[model samples]
Target chain A: MSASHPSDQDRNESLPGEAAARRVVLSVDAMGGDRGPATVVAGISRSARKNPDIDFILHGPKDELDRLIARKRGLAGRVTVRDASDVVTMHDKPSQVVRHGKSTSMWSALDAVRDGEAEVCVSCGNTGALMALSMMRLRKLPGVNRPAIAVLWPSRNPQGFNVMLDVGADIRADEKDLLQYALMGASYARNGMNLARPRIGLLNVGTEEHKGRPELKVAHELISEAAEQANFEYVGFVEGGDIPGDRCDVIVTDGFTGNVALKTGEGTASLIGDLLKEAFKYSPLSRFAAVLALTSLRRLQKRIDPRRVNGGVFLGLNGPVVKSHGSADAMGVSAAVKLAYQLAASGFQEKIAARVASAVSLAQDAAERGTETE
Target chain B: MSASHPSDQDRNESLPGEAAARRVVLSVDAMGGDRGPATVVAGISRSARKNPDIDFILHGPKDELDRLIARKRGLAGRVTVRDASDVVTMHDKPSQVVRHGKSTSMWSALDAVRDGEAEVCVSCGNTGALMALSMMRLRKLPGVNRPAIAVLWPSRNPQGFNVMLDVGADIRADEKDLLQYALMGASYARNGMNLARPRIGLLNVGTEEHKGRPELKVAHELISEAAEQANFEYVGFVEGGDIPGDRCDVIVTDGFTGNVALKTGEGTASLIGDLLKEAFKYSPLSRFAAVLALTSLRRLQKRIDPRRVNGGVFLGLNGPVVKSHGSADAMGVSAAVKLAYQLAASGFQEKIAARVASAVSLAQDAAERGTETE
Candidate 1:
């Protein structure tokens, strides 16, 4: 596989300066986005212009990516194009991809992180396939039964975003899995949003102590007990409404509920946006009002735009991977790249690993104590 | 208990004319709402003004309700004030409410529907307590394992609202329950939205056939098999985004997921509204634009207002019960009363009962056929 991509080695060896080696290298899958590799190159170019201390291990067909990269002056010596024959499509099944996705650009991109060449991998591809390839190449951290995908949600918080997890990693999460999600989500908030001691809220139907499924009750107790050891505040139970409110900085739930809540929020925001447009276009006066209010409306749009928070970081993996939206444009991809760079700079992967490792031991000790008391 | 509330019988017999007996009588609980009986009475008065063929059996303390109803000239001959000594507070546990809530307005409200004195019941109370009391008083229909709470969501459909069920009835729903929810939801759509044959969608994490929990797959097959016999179109799996879209008329899921999605959507919509307001207030130019766009903005607001679609109907019971928002104002209460009247006029209770029975038999037949094949 390495022999097939000779251009990767050549590009790396032909770096312009020794100082360039110190730049944060992000593994990027260029072929899997809906807008194709040109948008991806443009996104990386945007990031290169903003951040002087970053490089990209661009994975795709070498000739096509090289051509795209050559057009961007800012990305000249900042990219190392890797050759891969296949592109994992949006419709590809995760199971099939894991079995036969070796030659795909997504797989090649993950290998750059797996081989210690890049601190992070970012892909605008099928989320399930990206998660699968990431798990296969990077593997789960020790003591992690399930790796979660955490995303940033626009919220009423002063930081302007709330962290929510496992937004479609797997459907089911038991008490232990939820506890792990809380740990990982809190770490993400601390690093991603700069929360000193992020407040953790367990997502449920109601805020009552005795509501929701049996697992949630157990998870509630587990999360509460671990909050002290984990160095985060535990706000017992939170409903879906609290996800966007300032009630808590991190919301933890099973992937099923979290995913549905994420999509429902997105769908509703999109609907409201569409209705707003229709309202402006309803009458001549309103249309003119839209013009006068353009600056304010644009400011509102910039505040809540989903593209501003484009990356969904896969947590509990050996190496961090950011799954950008498949339909992301250049700005969206640049947002993801910026997030990946931040996480890499903050040593988020190592911090969360330490958090989960401590949590596992804490759980084991609590279980042994429960057995002794019984 | 009925003997103690003598005012109920006296007011019932004090009707204006025999023609009033032909009107739709809604059993409305006046005390349990966040706003007192005044808001509830104002709500019924608004409804009475708009709808000539509707009357109410207003349940609460006799003296308080009589004063409130006497003030509303529109509600003079239309309201029958029932005396109930207790009020079910929002903080009351559902189990506690069921055991000791016999004297509450919410309980008395359901009794009017249970005893055939009213066609439907409407209450602005604790949803958990309302559902518990509804089940206790009206009981589940035959072959109905779990009763579901269905609400009207603003959608892209021409009808402007799509039905989503099991919003917070119970945390768990097996395949059979989900199938029954489909049946009940379809019936609600047909009667509530006046759709000839409603399209039903099963809510899941993903739209893929192989995705989601094991029970959802089983529900997918069961719902598919029953669609033709149940007189609805099965759209297979739908994700959360489709809940507000026009992809289907009915979205069915277990109570946990449905409740979370509902709250998440409401929260997101509210957040956007707040952000929009903040945007307009940011600058003097934008404030002027807001004044000019007031009518258009008002139009948009009315179209998506949650108050307009206020009722959450408890289905799969012998009688229908509308659970309005506890914080609903007079206009919100009027919207709920309107929904309750529409449901009663459409013979929605009997229609859903018949639909569920036919689905039970259809499921039985499918099971037998499956056994034969096996």
Candidate 2:
């Protein structure tokens, strides 16, 4: 909250709002998720009714969204549809959508955020496309090398879960990019987790020097040196298990590995659930046991619902962008809509951008000075 | 069973009664698991009693094993320990331990298997050290270029789980290693799952050839070519989610990525379990509901237990080498021991080695011949 605002903050303030109490959070690319706009409409409609303080504008195919809205008249209360023909499907290549399919829902949604029509833009389109679009349209914060997607995985430890960045954004990375990811992740944890100055960990196989591939080893050095100069806590190294445990709070990894771990976590959770059900089917007696355990199972299901954590915040962009989960249903979409509004009103984007820019500049200056000494 | 054996098998089998059904499966570092040798003892004792067809030589600290076994009279039966003070803890650097600690339980264990005192060797110690010892003592299969670890992950399809290979063995992998992993994984599924010529899928980010990193693209080409000349079916590329949902019977990946995925899966499952308990704790009514649902919950827990899965079999070695889960308890260690025995009795080592040798030779010859055309 003490951080200085960007140049555009003044512009945004006059055009729309600041960290205000209540406002509308417009959503773009409503038809971007697994179930398309219907689910998006359902989520936002529900969210709108639940949060009377907020309003909604769904951007997508007018006809499809309208017909879907007609089916749920009660949900149409605080929601309105802004028709855009483009709908990004799961099968569409990310580049194709970004470079060529600009007319799609994602772009329209991003435009809403850009023009101040929407306080926040949210979509579950291709992660790469979303990153590219948000960065290209909204622009990157000063001193940031690139934007990143941050996901909070459920931790097994008593301490809360850690935030992992660049899940599927930068495939080819360097030590510099990794440093930025750490700073961005830390800034996110600070705002998202409400930490004063969060701890950041570089995800690695081992803690020793030269432990990972040449690039990662160097990245570790850079992050450690940068963290020393920055205001946040820098934990030396974290293993795979540490991300989901109390071992660390902010995990930094390349997009390639991060994406693999994130998706692997998702798939594994699903497998465990399915496998547990099958185990109960081993015999009639076990089946009866499964019935008895239904209440615990339901609670567990809610705790790790794929839908609950559907939105991934695209950090380091100029404005707020919430990337919806790939398989988000109505509830997931609705929650994401509320999440975007909260993020916008919470001043998350401005706060993170200010902190990251300041920290990164300091790191760069320190690195330059170190080189000069050498 | 029909294939030719690798060089290690040939060297080991030269000893007296080495090929006999009652051969001993020597575990060098049996005391390394979290639960110590109790699990190993149970596994070895259980197999000896059930089959009346095998013996187990525990090449570890005899006094320590005795001290523990003294507390459990019934399980101490059918297992023998060779008093060896040397140990290789999980944290020991692999090369350092192998070079300086050759007399360690790990090395001694592998030595037993190598010198023909045991038919196979299983260890729960430092995995890297075990791999080094296996390779150093037994040597790589004549034509086999690399060794890999294969474990079956529970999938969603009614058909059950799928086998994924090379989960953290080699670091910088080439296409040939992936192809070999695929072949080895298929063999395991055929024997372990009783599936005839199971389907094989490359654990890739996408179905397209250019989807993954440079290495994967090259690996995909080689795998497709290898599949054409192999005995099993090659299904094609698969994403992460495919592993849990049984998209294919065999999934292949380089060890680095595989290891992260496996651990993430394990963490996710545990995280869900914790979250469920937390959710239930939210209310007194929910607590009662959790109790009522305990039956189904237990079934789920039983289905996804890492202990049930036990260990990952290190393929491409001269003999059957099972690496128990790093965090294995007494029960899991015991299970891995039984698996090692089963691998020996089923002649899995001989078959794998032979197949690997022939396949490697064939692949090499083809490469040499094919390069002429290119």
Candidate lDDT (C-alpha), each? 0.87, 0.70
Once fitted onto the true fold, the runs of candidate 2 whose alpha carbons sit more than 4 angstroms away are A1-25, A52-57, A63-82, A156-161, A206-210, A277-295, A360-374, B1-17, B21-28, B62-81, B157-161, B277-295, B361-374
Scored by TM-score, the top model is 1
The alpha-carbon lDDT assigned to residue B147 of candidate 1 equals: 99
The complex in candidate 1 yields a DockQ of 0.78
Q: Across all candidates, what is each one's fraction of true contacts kept?
A: 0.85, 0.47
* lDDT tens digits, residue span A1-374, model 1: 00011112213343322323335789999988999999999999998887767788999999998888888898887788899989999888999999999999999999989988888999999999998888889999998899999999989988888999999998888878888999999888877777789999999999988788877887888888898889999999999999999999899999999999999999988888898899999988889988998998999999998888999999999999999998999999999988887787667878988998878988766644534543
What lDDT score is found at residue A88 in candidate 1? Answer: 96
Give me the displacement of residue A181 in model 1, in angstroms.
0.7
Against the true structure, candidate 2 has what lDDT? 0.70
lDDT of 1 by residue, B33-122 (tens): 999889999999998888777778999999988988888888787888889989999999999999999999999999998888888899
Report clash pairs, candidate 1. Answer: none
* Tens-digit per-residue lDDT, A238-295, candidate 2: 7677767776778888777788788778788777766666666777766665565566
Candidate 2 chain A, poorest ten consecutive residues by summed lDDT = A1-10
